[model samples]
Target chain A: GIQVEQSPPDLILQEGANSTLRCNFSDSVNNLQWFHQNPWGQLINLFYIPSGTKQNGRLSATTVATERYSLLYISSSQTTDSGVYFCAALEGSNYKLTFGKGTLLTVNP
Target chain B: SAVISQKPSRDICQRGTSLTIQCQVDSQVTMMFWYRQQPGQSLTLIATANQGSEATYESGFVIDKFPISRPNLTFSTLTVSNMSPEDSSIYLCSVRTGRGNTIYFGEGSWLTVV
Candidate 1:
């Protein structure tokens, strides 16, 4: 089983600030995804980057598969972004994804 | 992208009772996964549901306690049997579309056992 570890278990960012979150996996992964869990417990898919780099608006993610780590960047963050961010990965042929403990982000308005 | 209509957004049930949460996907997805989010905790995988087969449970989850049914590609049900206060948490269902492999989750059903 692959272990997923997220950096900065907790984070605080004032509105209009920027932040970076990192996720490291113990082994090679067949798939990887980033998600945001809102205050109301809704899981929002942020990005599904098994490899390479992707950007959506003010948010961007990069996965260096060789190093088995991924990073998520949020620029000029907003209050609505306050919540826990999770990175999930599936090792080898396992379709079941193992998730990190999560980075609890608190964005002050 | 597909829309998932999850019922009973939130509920409070008495102990010893059971609750079955339903997840209906707009598209017929071959694989659906059930997850549990405990209070102040990260999401944990409960089981994987595939049409025409019984769900494969995770290490701590068992079929008797958390039974899952996937009768077809577009729908699945997860029943929490003999519920207790510890069972109170948010239950979510996610799906993967064919081989593309990015999974998406529903809004989740919040349960409070008392």
Candidate 2:
């Protein structure tokens, strides 16, 4: 029902660099999450932020529900951070996540 | 937080044969979700399984291709029927504790069809 779009389809960063990823949804959402898909293909939840800002180590996320968009920030990136970062949302109570295409980040050492 | 275990962490299947993937949750949950992640892609919602009720699948996915069964609150199974190379991807199961958004996933089942 809702559409999710992610910006910067691909990114290349040097070790210790910083970058920002954005996700914009077409409809209102109550549950929004940032996930990191590692090389092994495990979807690791980074933050469950429907609104406001949250920081976890070097990764941080901010969601502006009113604007229907969210931003993910990765500071001082490491090679281990190389993978695809995805943003998903829950439009209704069912809470089933509708995911964005994702932002692929490659950090070269 | 919930700990999830998926049977046969990885498998190799021959085309035209079907395979079942099992998802087990340590604690009972009201909502269980099935997802597929293709190579170099993001997660795609396959369906949402609720205990004692039928699963609601996404638009492109069909019941005939991916049949899901949630007989109980803590267990569910997804069967890929008449598998092909296109079905070769990573299938994952996740659960929500009912607070709404916090969804956790298992390690995932890697399927390779030859």
Candidate 3:
């Protein structure tokens, strides 16, 4: 099984601020995904980046697969973005995903 | 992308009881997964359900406790049998579609044992 690590266990930002979250994996992965768990406990899919970069609205993500790391960028953060952000990866032929502990983000008005 | 729907979004049960959670996917898939998210903890993979085959359980989970059924390519069911207080957690069903291998999740079934 592969290991996933997320940095900045906690974060607080004012509305309209920007922040970056990083995820590092112990081994190469064939699939990588980012999710935001909202206050109501909904796991919202943010990105499915195995390599290169992708942007969705005010959020963006980059995965450097060769280096076994990924970065998620949140620009103009809103209070609605307050939740736990998680990164998960699946390596090789494994169907199971290894998840990071998640970074708790709180955006205040 | 795939649309996943789960039944009984939340429930409360007594110890030693059993509950079955159903997962329905809009499109056919080869693999379906069940994950558990304990309170204040990260998500952990419970088992992988493949069509026409028995599920592969994780290290801490077993077939007797969390029996899973994959009767078809588009549907699966996970039953928490003889559960206890420690079994209370949010159980989610997920799958990887053909579109770039993007994994999608259901809303999850939140269970509480008293």
Candidate 4:
């Protein structure tokens, strides 16, 4: 089983601000995903980056699998971005994902 | 990508009772996973449900307490047996889909035992 640690347990930002969230894993992973749990509790998949970088609109994520760390960047954040961001990783051939505690972001207008 | 639909979005149950949450995926998948999110806590894997075989429960989770069924490739069910206050949590169903093997989750079933 792999252990995931997400940093900046809590964050507050004004609209239009930029921020970065990080996730550190204890072991090598075959799959790494970033998810946003909105206020209504719907878990939205933001990225499936096991390695390299990807961007979707204002959200982008980079996973350095070799380093066992991933970074999520939010650009020009908006109030709608307020929620808990979680990073989950799957080690080896395991089908289950180990999740981090998450980074709770509050983007205030 | 797979679209997951979970039944009974939220429920309130009395202690000693049991509830079953159904997960339906629009596309076929090889493996389905059940996870629990306790109040203010991160998601934890309960078990891995594979079609045609018994589920593999994770440490701290038992088959008797959280029995799972994967009757087919597109559907699965998870039952919370002998419910108690501590058993109350958000139960989510997920699967890996597409070429990326990206995982997708259902909206989740929120349960509260009193």
Candidate 5:
């Protein structure tokens, strides 16, 4: 079983701020995903980056598989982004995800 | 994108009772997963359900506590047996599909045991 660790258990920022959340894995992974859990309990898939970099609007993610680490970047954060950000990693071919503790982000308007 | 719908978005159960949560997907998928998230905690994988096969449970999770049935490709059910106050949490249904084997989750079934 692989372990996923997310940094900065909590974060707060103004509406126009930028932030970076990091996820470190204890072992190699075949799939990595970032998710956003809104206040209403909807888990939204933010990115599916197993390697390389991907950008979606103001949110971007980079996974360095060789280094066993991934980074999620949010630019000009908004109040809508106030929620829990989770990073889950899947190892081997089991298709099971090991999730991190999550980073709680609060963007003040 | 996969559309996942879960029944009984929220519920309250009594100790020693059981409740079954239903998960339905818009498209047929081979691999479906059940996850649990305790209050203010991260998600934990409970089991992996595949059509026509017994689900594979993760460590610390057993079939007796969380039984899963995947009768077909588009539907599955998870039953929490002998519920207790400690069992209060959010149970989510997820599926992996399309390119990159991306996973998508439903709105989750929030359960509170009293």
Candidate 6:
């Protein structure tokens, strides 16, 4: 089984600030995804990046498959962005998506 | 994008009881997965449910404890048997559509065992 590690277990930011979250996997992965779990307990898909980079509004993610790492960037953060950010990697051998413990982000208004 | 709907968004159950959670996908999906999120913990994959086949349970998870049924491509059910307070967690259902391998999740069923 592959192991996933997320950095900076916690983060604090003010509205309009920018922050970057990182995820590192122990083995090769067939897929990588980022999710935002709102206070209400809904896991919202952020990005599905097996490789390369993708952007959605103020949020963007980049996955370097060869390096076994992924980064999620949030620009102009908002109070709505305050939640747990998770990075999951789908292992190629077992095809199981393993999740990181998550980074708890707090954006103060 | 697929629309996933789960029944009994939240519930409270007594110890030694069982509860079945239902997962319904708006479109036909190739793979469905059940995950458990313990309080203040990350999500852990319980099993992968494929249509017409027995689900593949992950390590630390067993078929007897969390039995899954995949009757068709669009629906599935996960039953947590003989649950205890340790089983109190948020059970989530996720699906992978054939479109591009992107996975989407339902609202999740929050269960509290007392």
Global lDDT of each model? Answer: 0.92, 0.91, 0.93, 0.93, 0.94, 0.94
Across residues A1-109, which tens digit of lDDT does each residue of candidate 2 receive?
8999999999999999999999999999988999998888878899999999999999899999999999999999999999999999888877788899999999999
Candidate 6 lDDT over A41-99, as tens digits, reads 99999999999999999999999988999999999999999999999998764556799
- For DockQ, candidate 2 versus 5, the one ahead is 5
Each candidate: chain B TM-score: 0.97, 0.96, 0.97, 0.97, 0.97, 0.98
List clash counts for every candidate, in order.
0, 0, 0, 0, 0, 0
Model 2 residue A101 lDDT score: 95
Name the lDDT of candidate 4.
Answer: 0.93
- lDDT by residue for model 5 over A1-109, one digit each (tens)? 7999999899999999999999999998989999999998889999999999999999999999999999999999999999999999989987888999999999999
Of 4 and 6, the candidate ranking higher by DockQ: 4
Native-referenced Cα lDDT, model 5: 0.94
lDDT value, candidate 2, whole model? 0.91
Q: Look at candidate 5 and tell me the lDDT of residue B65.
A: 94
Deviating ranges (above 4 Å) for candidate 2: none
The ten-residue window of minimal lDDT in model 1 chain B covers B95-104
For all the predictions, what are the DockQ values? 0.86, 0.75, 0.78, 0.86, 0.87, 0.78
Candidate 4 Cα deviation (angstroms), residue A75: 0.9
Residue pairs in collision within model 2 = none
lDDT of 4 by residue, B1-114 (tens): 889999989999999999999999999887799999999999999999989899999889999999899999999999999999999899999998645667899999999999
In candidate 6, what are the lDDT values of residues B1-114, reduced to their tens digit? Answer: 999999889999999999999999999988899999999999999999978989999889999999999999999999999999999999999998878757899999999999
Please say which candidate is ahead in lDDT: 1 or 6.
6
TM-score of chain A of each: 0.97, 0.98, 0.98, 0.98, 0.99, 0.97
- How far does residue A108 in candidate 3 sit from its true spot (Å)? 0.7
Instruction: Give one digit per residue, the lDDT tens place, for model 4 in A5-48.
Output: 99999999999999999999999998999999997778999999
